[model samples]
Target: MGERRSTSQSLVSWTRLRPYAMISPAILVFCLFFIYPIGYMVYLSFHDWNFVSPTKEFIGTANFTYLLSNLEFREVIVNSFIYTFFTVFLTIGISLLLALWLNRGGAIYSFLQASIFSPHITSLVSVSMLWMWIMDADYGLLNWALNLIGIESIPWLTSPDYALTSLIMVAVWKGIGFNTLVFIAGLQSIPKDLYEAAELDHTPPWRRFLRITVPMLSPTLFFLTIIGIINSFQVFETINLMTEGGPINSTNTFVYYIYQYGFQFFKIGYASAAGVILLVILSVLTVIYFKVLSKKVHYR
Candidate 1:
């Protein structure tokens, strides 16, 4: 009888632990890939180390101080914010308009929607390469088209004045299709009865949209806003491929700045500090976004 009791107790214990055992691999992966890297990055931020160095020198906050006081780093921060602002604003605004116009059912609308979204599905590297050719100062499609309209060739990526603006344009163009599709989905989810009820009161088109449509889309708008801010702040591929953060660092952003310091300049500690700053900024922005917009989002 004692032996039977022991076996039953052991079985119960194993059953209790089985779920945890099943999930252990996923937990291990999360720790290895996510938590470990972040912790190591934080550790590296406080020490000076070349990529090939045998040992890291403890520098405390010197790396951060250098970054904060550096004029180039300050400019990179400004460029990042400016790029994020324009990219998010234009992408959301234009996509919202497109979503409204294309929300109806039709073959033509379907084709147009597919066409718009095609750029988004294509790889970013390929898109960057294609845009490079299009925006080339000489013998580029954009300049060619402008010259046809009796306008002089404007340096799209070569001029400091236009380089950042050109990057913003590419980001907006790439993002609009995805945003529009998401907006369309949100619009469709909103019940038709809401509009019908508003129309019964002889409401103007704009008033109906403002009262019914806008409120219903608040959740979608909030979602897209947060995502746009995060993605825009991380813009790197286009800057790297198209401009290489050139035209006097007009297009230099946080990620590219970190890449330069870490990889090109081999300043691992400095790059880690920039990475830490980016992480902190993103975290603060996300928290603020949730706090401000949580009450505004109208669910179902």
Candidate 2:
């Protein structure tokens, strides 16, 4: 009897430990790839070293200090904020409207959804190249269309005034499909009974939407806002391929600035410092968003 009890205890112990053992490989990979690289980046932020340098010199905040004082870096930071603001605001707003318009489950709606989402899944390089041709000042489809409407050709990608706007438009076009899908899911999840009751009570359509749709979709909106802000701050591919941060550096954002410093100029430490600053800024923004906006989110 005592031997049997000991074997049962061992079996129970193994059962309790098995799940952790199963997940150990995933945990190891996460630490090795994600956590280690972040830690290394932070460590490198304090030292001055070119990629080809033999030894790194301890700069101890000099990189951060220089960036803070530099006008170009300051402009990059401001541009990042501007780009993120417009992209997130416009993407979420437009996506919500699209979701509302096509919330019905049907073949037509599905086809439209797929059509919108195709641009998102399409390669960024391909999309950028396509837009470059479309936005060409001379002999481009867009200019040709404008001429049909008796409007003169506008320099979409060449002028400083229009370059950032063009970038924002591309980002919005790419992001709207995903946001729309998320909103559609949120909208569909809402109970039909609420709308029926509102209708029975003679509630107007706009009021019903305001009271029912917006409140219920708050959680979805909150989630999309956070994600959009993060993505917009990391705007690199479009800027790199389309404008190359040209037209008086009007579209030069934080990530592009980092690439220029690290890869182009070989100021590894400065770039790392910029990276660390970006991480800190994102962290703070996320925290603030949760603290201030999360209370308004309706989980159900």
Candidate 3:
């Protein structure tokens, strides 16, 4: 009886430990890859080190102070905010429109959906290169088209006035398909019976949409808004491949600024400090997002 009781106790203990044992590998991997890198970056942010340096020199918050005082970094911050604002809102707005139009089941709708989403699945390198050709001021497709209509060629990626706008356009085009697909899913999940009831009361189309559709899609909107902000803030490939933050740093954003410092300039500590700033900005945005937007998200 004593042996049987001991065996039962061991079985209960094993059952209790099973879940943690199953999840231990994932937790370990997360710590190694995610937590460790972030911690190291934080540590590096406080010291001065070029990539080729044999040893790091303690610099305290000089990196952060320089970034704060630097005019170029301020412009980079402005550019990031501008790019993020335009990209996120345009992607969400246009995609919501497209989702509404294409939500029905039909072969033509399916084909159109696939066509729109094709750009999203394409590599960013390819997209950047293709857009470079298209937006080239001389002998480019955009210029050619404009010339045919008697409009002079406008420098899309070259002029400071239009360079950031051009990047925002690329971001929106690439992101819209995914946002639209998600919105469509959200729309489908909403109860059709509610719509039927509204229709029975002879509700206006606009009223039905405002009263039913918008509330039902609140959750999707909130999700896409947060994701869009984060992705737009981290934009790098398009700027790197297309503009290289050129035309006098007109297109220089946060991620590219960090890259320019870390890899191109070999200012590892400076870049790390910039990275920490980015992390803090994102964390604050996320917290504000939850605080301000959570109440508005309808979860039904």
Off by over 4 Å in 1: 1-16
- Candidate 3 residue lDDT tens string, 1-300: 999999999999999999999999999999999999999999999999998879999999999999999999999999999999989998999999999999999999999998888999999999999999999989689889999999999999999999988888889989988998999899999998999999999999999999999999999999999998999899999999999998899999999999999999999999999999999999999999999999998886
Each candidate: what lDDT?
A: 0.94, 0.93, 0.94
Superposed Cα deviation of residue 30, candidate 3 (Å): 0.7
lDDT for predicted candidate 1 compared with the true structure: 0.94
Better of 1 and 3 by TM-score: 3
Structural similarity to truth (TM-score) of each candidate? 0.95, 0.94, 0.97
lDDT over C-alpha atoms for residue 72 of model 2 = 87
Per-residue error (Å), model 1, residue 92? 0.9
- Positional deviation of residue 128's Cα in model 2 after best superposition, in angstroms: 0.2
lDDT of 1 by residue, 1-300 (tens): 999999999999999999999999999999999999999999999999999989999999999999999999999999999999999999999999999999999999999999999999999999999989999889899999999999999999999999999999999899999999999999999998988987898889999888888899998899899999999888889999998899898999999999999999999999999999999999999999899889888887
Better of 2 and 3 by lDDT: 3
Best candidate (score: TM-score): 3
TM-score of 2: 0.94
Worst lDDT 10-window in candidate 1: 291-300
The pairs that clash in candidate 1 are none
